[model samples]
Target: MASGTSVSPNANRTRSGNTLLVWSLLVVAANLRPALTGVGPLLDRVQAELALTPAVAGLLTTLPLVAFAVVSPVVPRLAARWGPERLLGGALVVLAVGVAVRWVPAAIALFGGTVLIGAGIAVGNVLLPSLIKRDFPTRVGLLTSAYAAVMGGVAAVASGVAVPISRAVPGGWHTALGCWIVLALTAIVLWLPQLRTPRPRSEAVHTRRLPWGSALAWAVTAFMGLQSLGFYVVVTWLPQVFRDSGVTAGDAGWLLFLFQAVAVATGLVMPTMLRRARDQRAVAMLSSAVSLVGYLGLVAAPGWALLWSVVLGLGGGACLVLALAFLSLRAEDAIAAGALSAMAQSIGYLVAAAGPVAFGLLHTVSSGWQAPIMLMCVAAAGQVVVATVAGRGTVRPTRP
Candidate 1:
């Protein structure tokens, strides 16, 4: 995180003019998760009203990961063609349309709109890091952490309010889901000025490509995927796990809300911690260790659910922010950063996409939560192992 170390060519470009652009980036970050998380709180109402089978209902969560994997690789190329700011603006436009389209009371529109929303988010996911690298390279650590907090905080709010918005809006779950269009629109409006600012030209400088053949790169990729998988597993199953332990559905829901709330704090703090550390191994190990304790605690004593949730949230949130930082930290320039983001996220999301389904299947096969819960513990340990290898300060020499 030292600006003097591996300075991206544009690292010197950070200045006061970025204040509005920074806020705009945060606004866009705010919209990225609401469309995804809002659906989870309202899923039961949606499934019953739409007469959806359990299998189909699951796609409501999985579609975003699918879109992320399918669209992420293409996003950098698209950004290369149309400036990142313009592409981000266009993606927000698509997100707005997608969020609004869900208002159409039909199953096709529900799934289709989710796909569109996911696709837009996928593009934003890849481009945002590169955008940060170009516009705020010197402040990468702070800006990344801040926007990450914005994204998590908005997601928590959306999840908490989705059901209430449904009741208040008259259209029930449909309106609840559609209400997020306001967030998307807010992003689009803020992002408009960025579109007018020309994308910086760094195309002429050819940095080495992403070090894909390096073991460290694969380690980083595994760390990203495992952390994502652990998070999605908790999000999809934690409430049910609590209910099985005799907690009421309402309180179980509150646990989910609490989880996200704690996550917002870690999202804001982890990058700053990473920036100050010489090597990230200790932070990485500590995060996974916290998650490990939480997983084991949930299995052994779900009665203390709130306590375990806060621990899991802290660890999971830290892991995610650090994974994001790896993309920026590992690469030397904007193009390399984009390539690394695309590589890590594309593979990472696909690995994560399997979490919910696999957990559900494991529960069904065992007729108990024990097996799936233990698998999560294994994943938490794996995170520590991979982070150790990936968190090394120096990248390996590029393969010929």
Candidate 2:
């Protein structure tokens, strides 16, 4: 029997509509990362201004992961009630407000704003793939590439210019952080048209039981966790690592920027690379191996941090892109994709939230970077173990 599916009959309204949709995708993708990555470069300034301890400073990064974990499970139900288009548009509006909320000079406001930002991004993270699965079903690879690239590229830009913007603007780090609101607001404006696009009505969807005990499911979830751990840890601490190694703060920010910049290219290309491979085990191992080498390099030589950052960037970028692809690739339908995504990210981000906090505590106790870098090495090994299985599994289609 044919399945009921909802699609926009006029999705390709005109040359103009197609162009607008593409622009809207890019802008929304661009909004997903900046609010989070923008804070990394400004962490030191925030810490000093707020008189926060190292552990507390680490929470700036950790809070978002926690929020992602906390909010991910609830997204599917919300999407069902509100529709993906309305939910996404609402998320952008909330994101813009969250960015603006940070403009007030208070610690409570900062953390509150971060929580809101994380919640908003969490919605986008869950919906974007499902949206791609819906609107660009046949062009998943290309569209995913474009989405990931824009996200990484803009995040790199945010990391690069954060400090300078802080200095040049009236409110220092507050303004630097708040500047992301403009982009979010732009995305919301571009996204409004999507709200007008008609969706076909269908019967109520029963919540499908997720495969909790499946090895492939566990593998996908673990791979997602480990990749997220690597990226969040590096983004949170790489600037500090370079600064401690005698690189100036501005240069360190740029190094972190370079790290994310290199990642943009890899994120853009990994999907095409995956499509060519018979199985992803070799590619998965290679990704972990590169990251392991990069982590080892950071452990052995702090002075060559820039080169190591790029290597780590390439590896982390590949893992992230691959993990995201697995959400779509491992599921056979939109509902299954939503279930897999919710399971992978809800649990995955809870696992990931530990990376920065643990690293910070380890650094505090050991009084060195060695222990943290070793922990990152362990994470890379874990990624290899999980991805080997997840990367090889065939898709399992489920119905609600």
Q: Go through the candidates in order and give each one's C-alpha lDDT.
A: 0.78, 0.83
Tens-place lDDT digits, model 1, residues 181-231 = 888888888778666655535543233344567677777788888988887
**Candidate 1 accuracy as lDDT:** 0.78
Candidate 1: segments with Cα more than 4 A from true spot: 1-16, 199-210, 394-400
Candidate 2 lDDT, tens digit per residue, 134-176? Answer: 6667777778778888999999999999989998989999999
Cα RMSDs, all models: 3.5, 2.0
TM-score of each: 0.90, 0.95
